[model samples]
Target chain A: MAEPVHEIEVEIKNVEGLHMRPAMQFVDLAGKFDSDIHVSNEEQSVDAKSIMQMTMLAATCGTKLRIKAEGADAAEAISALQELVEVKMFDETPGK
Target chain B: MEIKKGIAVSPGVAIARAMVIDSKDYRIPRRSILSSERTKEIGRVREAFDNAVAELTELEKDVAAGESQIKDIFAVHIRYLHDASFGKRITDFIENELVTAEYAVSTILREIASHFAGIDDEYISERAADIYDIERRLLTQLLGDVRRGVEHLTEEVVIVAHDLTPTQTAGFNKTFVRGFATEAGGRTSHTAIVARSLGIPAVVALEDVTASITSDSLVIIDGNRGVVIIDPDDDKMAEYEKFSRELTEFEVSLGSLRDKPAVTRDGEEIQLLGNIEFPDEAIMTKDKGGVGIGLYRTEFLYLYGGSEPTEQDHYEAYTEVAHHFEGQPVVIRTMDLGGDKLPYAGRQAPETNPVLGLRSIRYCLQHLSMFKTQLRAILRASVLGDIRVMFPLISNLQELRQAKMILRDVMEDLDEYAVPYNPNIKVGIMVETPSAALTASLLAADCDFFSIGTNDLIQYTLAVDRANEHVVTLYSAADPAIFVLMRSVIHDANKARIDLSVCGEVASEPEYIMLLLGMGVRTLSLAPPMIPEIKQIVRSVTIKECNHLARKVATMDSQRQIKNYLRDAATRILPEAF
Candidate 1:
């Protein structure tokens, strides 16, 4: 069977970028589904699971990113990742 | 054999073994490599840098999600990583200058880290810790090495450090870390604040404290007095143990009053309320038997972030407090920012004397948008329970009128929008300045109530900088001027037939409770822990006795006389009660 693919665009509204911890959480959630996920800013593409790659994309607090998910659970993975990226999750960690 | 002393911020005594966690120093390991291997090392270092940046990006996202205050730290880290020096200088030194990859990276990291560390500013120096932590992590990954050393935290150990960053304090494993002592920092420092919040005994700003004691040496730390006793004798240890037990018993006894009403023994009822800065503090207020929240400091909500909080955000916070108190009253103070409490909005420039600067209601009125958002939220939340709105630093009827006008305007707008709200919300002014106290009677007729903020009142009255160490000794709440102001404000509120309260540090001091009660203060709001003690003091004294003392205090010419009278009164009453 051909792998499924899904895409979603989200505008980052938080003042700080999708820095380390949030990316890790997004990756952890993505791992739960059998999906090949990739995230991209306007300039660069990065493997969603690779925290290093995601960070190098340097998505600022207000930067928008296009999330692409492919594989058996691509639809569910896209929905979960979109929600994770959209929600503010790093507000409590001091020195974030 | 030498002793150094600083201001004692928190109270507690503890004896423990000393454990020192120095900020870890990172040095690249020696590796024999040809030109090809050097190239691979550079690639590996690049990967490590990328990984570190990724970790920071994720941290930023988590921080943003939680709406945390320390987002700037991550922003600084991102800047450091992307700096021209990080890649350009190091790469040039390694490839062009023919230096070893490890040597180039180490030299660059040390140079940059030291530059940040050497800065005199505390905020700047704190950034150095972050740089160092990131650098160490990156170097370890590049070298394929692991830190073998593990500093095992023991139950009896007292943590000694140059200073603790907020991250260090938050990451502390409370199970084994019994207490903490620092060589630098004060009561308001993140270290001290975190230690107090975690219920750990800590003494800060003990100069050269790290050099004085070693790991496993028995030491006594008196957090209340800011004293550290090294290698104490058995007699001293035994004495401390006894004192600790007494303290534990005292805390337990106070805790037992959590559910009890704050009514005096003679049936004179007084409202004992909590002054809170966060929603989480509502739990603390309830746990400590606070009848309600007397002052919810709204400035904290506006301070951390750059933009103003949306009406919904303010509404949620106010509603949460109101719901927490249920049927009880929760007085939410409008944004009291200025001077020491600077907010992102309405701060045009630094003032020579911020105490007398344009602040509080004056600043809020100038920035109408910010002010109205807060007012609308407070009014909306008032429908949930007993919610009262307060304006801080009101000096005259004109400022009070202007503020009330803005509040009225916002309510009208909300009405036109058909927004749900309580139109009859009680509005009050904080009698913080001397001008406000002198004119309290006139202002009382215009407002529903008054809460005296003694912190600012004492400072403004005495003309002393409470934050300045050199002049802090003169910043006394017991000063005759402060007492006079308090008397004037309370008397004015009483004459006007409006509710009166003293919501300040003065309300928490056991010795001052009777004096304030005597001064015709029907309500006392303070930190939650202080409520029970003050309540206990109120229960021991009668309204008649308090009124008599009030008369005497009113006639007293000097603070010294008032202090002597109160001390004598406490001595006479405390023994009988015990």
Candidate 2:
């Protein structure tokens, strides 16, 4: 059986760039799906579910990210992560 | 007499014996564990990790709910402890490489931190600090016997440290630790905030305080001026001793004046009030027999809490202090901010000569909306207790009229909105500038009361920047020029039939009490700790004698002559005080 793979690209928009807080949120979201999620910049890729690996990517504001998910839940994982990066989860003020 | 300067984080002057606190002395042993002791070494590492996690969890819970940032920092520390990669790396070094748990942990963390330090992104690189912090905590746990902190002080001493962690600062012993000076910290650092909340004098950001100050050497922490003096000569020591004795003796004798009224022997009553920066300080005011709050510094509302406070914030703060007074006048000064006290750079325009430029009343006038918000809040707070709205640094009648007009506008808006407020809140002005002092009669005609701000008045009158050490010697409140100005202002206030008070450092000393009393300042407001001493002097002197002393000093031509005369008069009247 072939595993399904879903992929998407997101540009960082936060004023402080892709800092610890955003990376933490991204990892937390990745942990929710039963997929092997990988986030990457142009030069490097890392496991999205690993905080240390995600931090090692060192992405900043305006940096483009390519997210790939591979599993039965790959589509859902990719969609949720795309939405998180687009809406800038953990960046915007709460209740706004 | 080598003096070092840092940011003054807390107030008050403390002179005590110095003690060095160097947490770096907690060294870790570098030895390989034998294969036979592998199980024990593994157990030791596991125990260290378990204890570290438990301590962090306890620390997270112990932190106040408002300090969420600190809680988050502790959370990161816990995460590092639970990190599988970090644990595997350390365990591999201990089991396969034959190294001690302490050495393995430190070496692995150091390598990881150095790797992070090479990251181009600042946010990613700063994670190196987090790694270092976690490394130190784990090392401390692994080498338990070598732990060092302020927890072991046995006697009162001034702590000189590289820096203090929030946990260590929180556990400071007030009885054994007179004060603390640190090599790193800004005014808003956790150590500074905790030191201030504890009412302990602290000077931070002194780059080499710990290295320069030796243990058991006499040291002075002038938190008020942000200056630290180490190993003073005999002359300087004697001077500081006399100054310390006056404050200590005054505090000790305060108990006697608890039941006594602040009245002259000639039966003239005087109001002795406290100058407070925070609402909680009102408790000290009431404890020290302060009849009212003469100067409620409102600038702290902006400086503290990490943001510009809203109208609701000001209202709540003013209401809390007002409630403490129980109808006694709580004179709230509108934001006397600028110069070195500017909180945000973008909010205020930068100036070359901040002291002589946009500051205090000038700043309030320039920023009318901000000023009106404070006025509206103050008006709303007046219903809770007796609230007097006082403006600071009003050098001209126009500034007063403009400020009063804005207050009127705020009151009208509140009325239109059907909001409740006190309509007849007493309005007042601080006589801080020479121009303000000269025009005291005109200001008194418009204001309901007057409070002389001798600190600024002395600086402005002598054309001296009080903070500039080169010219600070010339800045004297006891100057003959100040005496002349005080006499004129008192005469004007008397003619205008408005209440006048002295609310400055000058009013705190017993020597200046008689001179101010002679100058017809019937009310005195100072730091809460100085109230009892001033009250004692107020109770002992006759109004006639004070008047004579004032008259004699007013004619003196020099600061020395005036100071000597006042000292002689103070000794004669209060022999026990000398």
Candidate 3:
């Protein structure tokens, strides 16, 4: 059975924005899921599982990105990515 | 079989096996593969990616858990290595383009690195280093031990590269990596600074060091002369061995002069101070027999620290030098940043002639708040020790007056906050421009002292750009015109009864020292490394002899004749040096 695709929009919160380390963390977390995940800025969408594509976003602080996941675990992927980008800010120190 | 000459950024001699490295993208010649060999090339690509990921993974565990910052750096490397899209790009290039795995990897990585380097965003552009680092790892795996470096090395080596990033230079294992040489770099490049701090010998700006040298061959890096000799003949090797030994002995002999005073044979006392670019060299200056810091350039602080440094940053750097000189006078030059060195925000339309444009005092005047911040910090640290302030490239009286007026304003600000400072802080201006030299008497009346910056004075007086190879021969500190300017400034300083010092390249040079002393310069401000040798010169010569040599050269019309006379006089005094 085809599963519903879950999607959410979030803003980068870290002062340094989505740099290499943060992009790597996001891609790593995305790799752990069974869902096929994709991320998009206003311009274009890319595979969230690929760090090379993710870092090309060059998303700065306050740049909005839409994350979508499709699979049985699509809801969990969306929630985890939202929390990482919005809540955890990829665990980057605040105001550095 | 070849000797390459470049600019030496550090001092030492190193002989070891050569490990040549190429940057992520530049100058990799294209190599092709047959269609029948495509499968093997693709297999090699997969193996290289797997091997690179394993290497980084092993390194990640070696890093301690508490050092998450370093771990994160490795994590990014590993993620790039494991990135399926990146691997596919390489393998697909190998299959479709019929190229060797190494060539495919090089071309693909080069394209990506150049793309990142071209990006306008600083954060994204800096990732070019990461791409380069990953390319190095994968290429080293595919090409084998010839390109291997740092953590993979089992024997001592001298790194030969087309170019090296500061990160790559800093990551070198001090014990196994004896030294390094590169085809491209400069004296002030971050890589050079790291090499200096690591105390490793490095030569840079070579024509092509990586292309000439064979892998694991015996190589010699003479950083003292900025020469790299590759696969020397036995006789040449033997000569260098003796030369290296003599140098070590020579340095030890110099150390013995540390306690001796820089007094001429006839009892003429001269102060040999040091010109330092960074605060860390303060101790070296004092240790090498510098009486004080004659010129502590603040340009590094201005350009470094990624944005304009805060007041605390200024204070901290100043105090670090002040702490080294307890009660000894340190002549701190105000920010002498060039027009081209300004931040993106403060910059204007590009000037066609930056050297003669808004720089030094002009830059300070336009950016008043930044200027005041530095002045306040310098004044705040003035109370710490005998800290004196000097302005640079002051071509006219108006600039000098304006700079002094700003200093007074900052002092008043400190007074309101009850922060104590040296109220009688001595102010001086660099006598670099010909205009300043000619009007020394006028400026000496308002300023506390004068320091002759011969480097620029020669340039401005002769109207020659030293960076131009064709006309640089015309630029000479010993030109009769330069002596005329020096004599005038010295005459003015003596007439006003103010302190005078020569804090320029001429001061450090042995050939010019006698002329400087004969021209009535009482203090010589030079690099710390040259202090002990200069002290030896001071101890060996009599002022009467210097005056006589000066007199003889003054009568000579030709600069070539003056240069020869000076060299003969200096060499006769110090036979071993020449």
In the range B305-342, model 3's lDDT, one tens digit per residue, is 45888899999999999998888889999888665775
Task: Write one digit per residue (lDDT tens) for candidate 2, span B410-465.
Answer: 99999999999889889999999999998888888899988998878987899886
Q: What is candidate 3's CAPRI-style docking category based on DockQ?
A: acceptable
lDDT score, candidate 2, position B414: 95
TM-score of chain A of 2: 0.90
lDDT per residue as tens, model 1, A1-96? 788889999865554556545554665577688788888887788777664455445565557899999998899998777767676444422222
lDDT head-to-head 2 vs 3, winner: 3
Candidates ranked, most accurate by lDDT first? 3, 2, 1
Q: Could you report the Cα RMSD, in angstroms, for every candidate shown?
A: 16.4, 12.5, 12.1
Weakest ten-residue segment in model 3 chain B by summed lDDT: B165-174
Model 2 misplaced stretches (Cα beyond 4 Å): A1-96, B1-177, B180-211, B214-252, B339-342, B345-349, B576-578
Against the hidden reference, what TM-scores do the models get?
0.61, 0.58, 0.65
DockQ of each: 0.02, 0.19, 0.41
lDDT of each: 0.71, 0.78, 0.82
Candidate with maximal lDDT? 3
Cα-based lDDT at residue B561, candidate 3:
85
